[model samples]
Target: MNSQFNFRFSALLILLVATLVTACKKGDNVVPSPDLGAQVAGTYTYSELKTGGKTYPASDTNLKGTIKLTRQTATTVAIQLAIVHKATNETFADDAAEDVEVVESGIGNIELHYNGDTIAKIKGTKISIEGEDDAGTLFTLFATK
Candidate 1:
């Protein structure tokens, strides 16, 4: 009976520790994980672009790539989009690039950074690239695990 009680007590102690760790959390300003939402961690498949009705190809010309994101601070981050469309023309894919620079992520949105004329960032899910030939061209991306 004592052994069983001891096991139960030990389990209860572990549970209590976990509960404290979770409930008595530190302040968000203390050790913020802004990077958790800052950069794109893995490979993302582009199945849809939320901007225009333009469709992606089944095999090639489909927008698919890995964007390496790094949070510079709580209000800013840097992302680089790699060009990985095999059947896509050089002008299109070559026009796309993987360059690193800081942009606005202060509003906690999915930031889209790309280059058409010059590089710019659009924060939100709609994939909005401002001031371009293809304004509002949807960028379909997913975080690849």
Candidate 2:
């Protein structure tokens, strides 16, 4: 009779513990992540440009540029580029902002995509973009806010 009572008591205690564990809510204390688009929205000046195994600083007389990023929506960012080619004394400016989808790539990294292609990556206050011109000159731009 004593062994039967002990077994029943142990079973009751196990059931109580199981119920308490399952009743507790998860993620109640978890902090939500910030919006990637909003976090990266700002004006960034080009710090460096790389092409043909050569790097040009922002102060380089040949090339300079600035990029403006605006948060268009929760998952979208608009980008506008203003660039100057000193050799040709020409300026390239976007008449309209291009929309790009911002997606979280990792814990602290975000990627910008346009037309199903990744055009840029943002980490902290820095952004790196890769593109080619009409003449097929592949270049990478590193900018910082």
Candidate 3:
């Protein structure tokens, strides 16, 4: 009876080990999340073009800037933006950090709100981002790494 019990226990142990091994196999349905920090850390040259408004002269509608993206965490980034009007050479600057939502492997979105309205909308990957701010004035940023 003792020998029979030992054989049954050994067989059960082997079956358990086999089940665990199968559960940990590589081809299982589990998938690893992509690393977001490594994909969006860089300095990008940006241009802000304003149009369709009577706020400024046509010559002053174009501006240039530089945007820097620093990774704050796996799901957050720090944005530094500076823009200068081409005609008047006036400068506008803004700095903020936001927690971004990943849209896919290489895409993300960040929205900045002022008084419940989304003043700035940021969407991009590591290579570039399209930023738009709509607060009294309209400006769109085209950024490239």
Candidate 4:
């Protein structure tokens, strides 16, 4: 009778421990990504510009610029680019604020979409953007806040 009782008690204890272990299993603690539009909404000055395999630094008198980013929504931002060409004293600028969508947000970077195409990325205080002009000249702008 004693041996039988001991066996029954051991079995019950083992069952209780197993149940507790299962009940205390780790849960899925999913954390959502940050809102990149709001996080990166600020003015940034051009650090460099690349086009047609030619690189222009910000110190280049003819191709210096700034970009303004305004948060319009949790996932959208209004961007205006203003670049000045000193030789001609011509200012190339967006006549109106263009709406850009923040399509993807990750741990260290955020991707931006313009006109249904991915054209920009923001990491830390820097933004890199690629675009083409009406003449089909491809360009990339690197800016920092």
Candidate 5:
């Protein structure tokens, strides 16, 4: 190649590489969500557990309640729910189990899956949950600040 052609070619190659590198780099303008899933973790006072359309309030035995996000990853999440006695502050043994990889988030609503089936959708700060034992059972929980 001639000197001028070689110079032009080199410039073009540099420009192409620069363009590709910039494109691959994450954009600073793009901002991520305010961590709606993080809000899912924490303690919740037992209001009730809803089955189908009816809400069954917890008994005096089930006074204190706690929900925890054991693992929060890019594409996976693990959660746990526990009940405790208000007076004794003792956590219930049988109720403290984790839901490993319970939800994969995308777009706006996060689809929660348990035992190879969809449980509910979580969006923004509101969570829609259903008992895995029965799909018909549904409950809505608002994320507390």
Candidate 6:
């Protein structure tokens, strides 16, 4: 009878311990959004296109090359631009480096600024830079990861 009673108490204790352990299990916790600078840091395929408030394929000589962007701070980045005219190999922005600011808040649109001017807008995996050259030739750069 004593052996039988001991077995019953031990079984109850085991069941209670199992219940307590299961009750202490953790639940899923949500993760926060990633930083804008961290997400945009990488290499990209840079395409130079004619600009009429939109992108259009132009000659390969319209400054065709890759653009490399490296994050320097939460609101600043170092840019390495290398572009060339395929016909004459006339390079534009060849190794031209600049530090630009990233505006991420207050308007809800992520934009890259150079000299307090909006140089590019970041959307998803794409970045578009629209401006004129030193000769006043309007062009747009579409870069994608």
What range of 10 consecutive residues in model 1 has the weakest lDDT sum? 124-133
Ranking by lDDT: 2, 4, 6, 3, 5, 1
Rank order (by TM-score, best first): 2, 4, 6, 3, 5, 1
List lDDT for all candidates, in order. Answer: 0.45, 0.81, 0.57, 0.79, 0.53, 0.70
Candidate 4 has an lDDT of 0.79
Q: Which portions of model 3 show Cα errors greater than 4 Å?
A: 1-21, 26-30, 47-50, 53-61, 98-135
The backbone clash count of each candidate, in order, is 1, 0, 0, 0, 0, 0
- Model 2, span 1-145: residue lDDT tens: 9999999999999999998776774546567766777888999987888889898887874766788889988788899877778677487434335679999999878998988988789888888888776788998888899
Model 2 residue 54 lDDT score: 93
Per-residue lDDT for 16-42 in model 4, tens only? 999888776744345566676788899
Residues 1-145, candidate 6: write the lDDT tens digits.
9999999999999999998877766333445544666666777677547566655553443456776778887667777766677667787655544678777744456787888788777777777776677988887777777
lDDT string, candidate 1, 1-145, tens digits: 9999999999999999998887777543376444533453333333333335454442434455444445554434455545454456332222333443334456744444444232443443333232322454445433232
Estimated TM-score for each candidate: 0.36, 0.73, 0.53, 0.67, 0.43, 0.61
In model 4, the runs with Cα more than 4 Å from the true position are 1-28, 87-89, 105-107, 133-136
lDDT by residue (1-145, candidate 3, tens digit) is 9999999999999999999999889568777665555455677676434345433333355666777767766655566776666667777656555554323332366443333444444566323333445565544555566
Candidate 2 regions exceeding 4 Å error are 1-24, 27-33, 86-89, 93-98
| Global CA lDDT computed for model 2 | 0.81
Candidate 1 wrong stretches, greater than 4 Å: 1-43, 50-62, 88-145
Model with the higher lDDT, candidate 1 or 3:
3
Relative to the true structure, candidate 1 reaches a TM of: 0.36
Error of 4 at 135 (Å): 5.8
